[model samples]
Target: MSMGTKQAALDGVGRCSRSRPQRQSGVALLATLILVLALTLILGNIFYRHQIDVSQATGSLHGDQAMLLAISAESWARDLLASDNDDPEVDHFGEDWAQAIPLLPVDGGTIVGCLVDLESRVNINNFSSYTDTSLRAERSANANNMGLVKLWENLLQNMGFVVDESRVSVIVDWLDKGDELIGPAGAEQSDYSGFNPPRFPANTYIADTAELAAMAGYSLAEVQRLMPLMSALPGPTTININSAPEPVLMALSGDLGIDFVDMVLDNRPFLTLQEFYQAIDIRLMVGEPALAIRWPAKLIDVKSDFFQLNLEVTLGQSRLEVKSIMQRGESGRPAVIRREITVVPAGVTTVPSRSIDTDDENAADFSGSGRDRFSDPDEYDREYYLRPICEIADSYTTGDLDDSGEQF
Candidate 1:
């Protein structure tokens, strides 16, 4: 070996040492990158969970606010109805209480509500008072039953639904407190046994009109079509002629054609039952004898006892809908009989401007024209507060107010 060979060996050793450090540095960099990735994943998961919790808390807060606002609106409606005792004999669209609560902005979002006369629609529960079976039997024997049956038939035909008298019989059997079938067309427990989920007829008043879909021979679609014109009140309720829709007015008698309904609506807000009868005679050119045979006075009235308040409240991302039924008596404050609250998707709604188009030939159309009676929000809000003291005084007799110390 010579000196040149030794030098070559030294160079090889240097190259080896340099390559070892480069490999180690590469491994260390890989480890550091792996550690960073792991920390990032863990932190991301924690942040995501925190975000979800915050969203849930915010939603809950909004929901609570919406509920409270709905309750306040319901109280307002009850008070409005109670204060309407000044003209307790009539409930017309022209009345202050009948006005819709025009959209009003609130602290967090907005709220809108309206009062509807439930008596304007036919009451399916009117068939049976949900009392003793004997009373139901007695009512069935009365002229009102026949009149109601006729009205139901007329309404179905007008709405383009298949008129099946058997369906009416089934409803009758369902409402009656008796186990006996109404007729061969009626459904009893035996008829319902074949249903997908076997059930029996609720032999009592229905809390909601949706129950009508469960009856035999009726479909959900048919019930939906009839829902706008019908109600399932707690007991027998007369149809309010002052606020009844044109369809209901047309259903009142076979003799009442579209022209007659238009005339009746044109001369609206009948002050008394006698005034309504007089309008009928004047429009039909027929005497009370013909009217008596077709229409039953007991089944109709100018006043309403049951009113429904439909309110919508919004708070942040939450939207809530509330419906409350109030029963107004001849005296004292109106009481809330039923209440329903639901959470819906968040969104905004636009309230259409209301104006009575009297120049239009169809101005007497009840559905559209009647809605036009609601004034602006400012006007609607001021109505209750600005009511005359004399009107409040009229709510009670002088002797009663003197004794109760409730006089204004």
Candidate 2:
């Protein structure tokens, strides 16, 4: 009994020891599997975050590159304008500056730029009494005001805007220093106060063409239509005949019909005012006696001093646009007066090819043209520059005085 019992007990103890080790081995295998899964999840999270960081970094780099390219393009344009001949008189599409810069390849990007003569368009600020100090003392017949009014009326009519003549008076009244109403159609501070928002008339030179939308009776669409044909500079400026649009040319005189306008535009780059006059037949213009009576040679010139440069740069999926206002100084070098930048999303084209043929029947048709002449303020970059209305008015107020005591 003692021998059998001892042998059985020893065998049971050995089996129990071996079975315990097997159970421990199974537990170890399970723990190893859990550790491997946890490591895989952590590594996956880190990889995903790394990928996001890389993508963000890439986008930022592209944006910086696009902006740099745009700045470079603007500098190039300024240089080109500075290098122009000393003749401050003639700005024409035929000039090298008017030509669009070809798509130039840069470090992982492409850039294009073009220059436009701001003086080619009628300056609405010319109507501001603040620009004419004489109007501040007393309201009287002003030749400059009269000429600008006539041109504004003509431009509105030609653009298919059938506005009342009184609308022009209202705009002038808003600009004139006198609080007195200009005419039956004129508006003053009281009229603007009646608006839902109670907007006050500027009573000063307009800082931007967009300010025209604030006119009491005009719609935003109507104001926008006029934007392409008008500008609001610090002072009165003569129209550049070489760069003037056909509508502006026609507005110069009623007798200058579409044919005459087309003729002048077709034969552009007129070296001098005499060359421009010699090219046109004055006899045809006589058909409208008013044209012969009010030949606007004084209101027009062959050259331009203010210009706008539009540049676009594309780098990878990023796009940027820059608009710059340049004024030629006495030193013959153009100085940048204003600059604005815009960032566009991927796959969007910001710069369009320059169109030299103003005669294209569809050229002035802004509807469905797929081009936006007005740059949205929201799209402007952090460095956007806009002259304040007070600053512009002050500039005119301090300018040289003419014999009539008006600011020149």
- Measured over all alpha carbons after superposition, the RMSD of each candidate to the real structure, in angstroms, is 13.4, 10.5
User: Per-residue lDDT tens digits of candidate 2, residues 97-161?
Assistant: 86767879987888866677788888887766433343332234433232566677766766666
**Which candidate number has the best TM-score?**
1
Model 1 scores a TM of 0.74
Candidate 1 stretches with Cα past 4 Å from truth are 1-21, 84-86, 129-146, 283-294, 346-408
CA deviation > 4 Å runs, candidate 2: 1-34, 83-86, 130-146, 173-181, 188-190, 193-200, 278-281, 284-293, 349-408
How many pairs of residues collide in model 2? 2
Model 2: colliding residue pairs: 89-303, 90-303
Worst lDDT 10-window in candidate 1: 396-405
Clashes of each: 0, 2
Model 2, position 241, has a per-residue lDDT of 78
